[model samples]
Target: MNRFAGRVVAITGTGDGQGRVAARRFAAEGALVVGADLDAAAAALTEKLVRDDGREMLSVAGVDLTDEADVVRFVGAAADRHGRIDLLYNNAAAARLGDVTHTSEADFDFTFRGVARIPWLLTKHAVPHLRAGTDPAIVNTASVSGIVGAGMVGNAPLLAAYGAAKAAVIRLSQICAVELAASGIRVNCISPGLIDTPAVAGILGTGVDDRLRGWHEEQTLVGRIGTPDDVVSAAMFLLSSDASYITGHNLVVDGGWVASGGAGRPHRDVVEALEASLAAGLRY
Candidate 1:
């Protein structure tokens, strides 16, 4: 699967997790990978891992994706090196979590700005280079939370801002697809559900959330938690020639969790407890 051979791929959030996985996979598949991240050390480590794998990868560290200047620098470096960018992966997001009533103005603004604004900035700057690319494509990472209200453990609606931001991401991808269509550039997104990443595990109070994994597996028809490989595979296909005709699409890579539609949502008691907590003016 050397579909990306000789192609220049610019990806965000390559410091770790899904971004790291995607960077490695792209490098392994013969792409000239250029990556950026907010964590300097972690991004360097990702670069080292790719180089250790005997693949080509160059990474920039401490990149603030929400900043248009930073996004332009990231895109500019790639174009300056390769003369064109063959793919753009808008895969970075760092934001806050809070329910509407308690969420501060600053946190809400930062959350929406981080999750939704960066992708647009990257796409805008990368567009000029992509216009000169070979069968270029872009993949944005949204979440299943964007498709529905992101009620969490105990039915806590603590991620309302993130959900709204991701919903904007989904819409951004669609609009970009239509706007970039004349340039032969395809744009799409993958909305994943309950992926068992390190971030998710930590949120569940451990290095690994076995109980949470089991609960989601039971709910998802696939009987397992989603993995970075699952996302990378779907993303690669969208960027590949196989999906040349596809654009303006949102691929729900949730292992059928969304289709099942809250089949295993928290019990009624939990929802009631949440309602009570809210009524009491409890802060998440």
Candidate 2:
């Protein structure tokens, strides 16, 4: 509703998915948007989306958020272009799936850095400009994985490191909220449940698509999986004045999965046993 008119927003991971949606939505709200992503093509695509809407947006490709230098450059360019920074949306991250027992050192580190360190690095540099901007706020993307284990979300059992890294993000957002309060910058995070995003297209693809999709939909209390727009709406609220009193808070955009205590998920043993019973002679 144009709440962000004239506001400058710097978003990470704008190459696609939630980040791309964020860039376009923020720009649509009249916010001056700048974005970065490791995917040059995807980042350019986000820029084009905003442009196609007849809005201006600057996007930098191949930005390694784990690298302090790249983080600094991205933040600096946003400030230089907009003369201030009103929002920092730390929305980029990726992870490799492997059991904790099988997860290599490189994989763990890669996930940890991508999921957690990017926010820290971006905040480190953007805080200065944000200090001078109007209604400055930082919204980092966390996942329900941070609050729970991989088992709680889905059958993917290799997200130990990703969970650990996102846990750090949860704590980081809390820290920044307190640290940046004196400077008039609000810090918060959004923890999304399993959503329909490109990141998981492979996992939910192929022969297992229908099965896993059904499982996920059942696991959620709302009887459906989440969407990128589901998260974008929550994020928009947190960035808007409606949530001006909120800080150091994590908004979970799951469709009641967390609240349901993952009640919809039945243990494999139970399911198998029940099937055996049905096949044998146990019938209604």
Candidate 3:
């Protein structure tokens, strides 16, 4: 659509999944994409794929997003290469599922720092360039876990830190949006639910994909798992002129899972139990 023609986009975790998808999408729409990832080879591959499609892409491999110095350098390089930053997608994150008791200090720090603090670092550096760019906007990748309590599965507390950190990201978006609105910049967050991404599959391990996928699909009102494209589309909307009036909003791209309430047998049981209570006039 060339909606981003002449614009510059800087995205993190571009090695794969939604990060790579977003990089390609923006590039195809005529933006000069700057992609950074910890996995050098994967980042290079993403650059190759986009360039092969005749799109402009600059790939920086092995980025330590949580490091302030590294984030400064990354943002500086993007601005230097393109003379401005139009969109900054804070798409990089690392997660370890464990209850607060079992989750080590290191793991908890890593998850929260990566999910929440990294975006703060990037935005702190990118805002100046964004302030001067055309239609500048920022999209942060939060999760439905942030909105809810990650109570769908038995291991809900296992992701306590991750969910809390993501909730922080949503709050960060709101704060950044209010702070940047005067500067002609918009900040928004997306809370996705059970998207079919490489990271999720990796976390699920072998031989469990089909079963988990099926469960999630049934739980989601859309009756299917979300794709990278679904997220990228929502991201593009916030970054585009169409969402000019939108800011500090958390868009739930969960296929109506959150709106519908719960999932599978547990959700049904909750409803049935509630109905039983109401029908019995047990209100005191």
Question: How big is the positional error of residue 138 in model 2, measured in Å on the Cα after superposition?
Answer: 0.5
In the range 189-239, model 2's lDDT, one tens digit per residue, is: 999998888887765553656777777778877888788999988988999
lDDT of each: 0.87, 0.87, 0.86
lDDT of 3 by residue, 1-284 (tens): 88888889999999999999999999999988998988999999999999888887988888898898889888888988989999999999987778878999889898988889889999999999998799899999999889987534443566788989999999999999999989989999999887778888744343756665566676777887789999999999999889999999999998888886745334677789999999999983
**CA deviation > 4 Å runs, candidate 1:** 151-154, 207-210, 264-284
Clashes of each: 0, 0, 1
Q: For model 3, what is the error of residue 270's alpha carbon versus the real structure, in angstroms, after optimal superposition? A: 11
Ten residues in a row with the worst lDDT in model 3?
A: 202-211
Residue 118, model 3: Cα distance from true site in angstroms = 1.0
Native-to-model Cα distance after best TM-score fit, residue 196 in candidate 1, in Å: 1.8
Positional deviation of 40 in candidate 1, in angstroms?
0.5
Estimate the Cα RMSD of every predicted model relative to the unseen true structure: 7.7, 4.8, 2.9
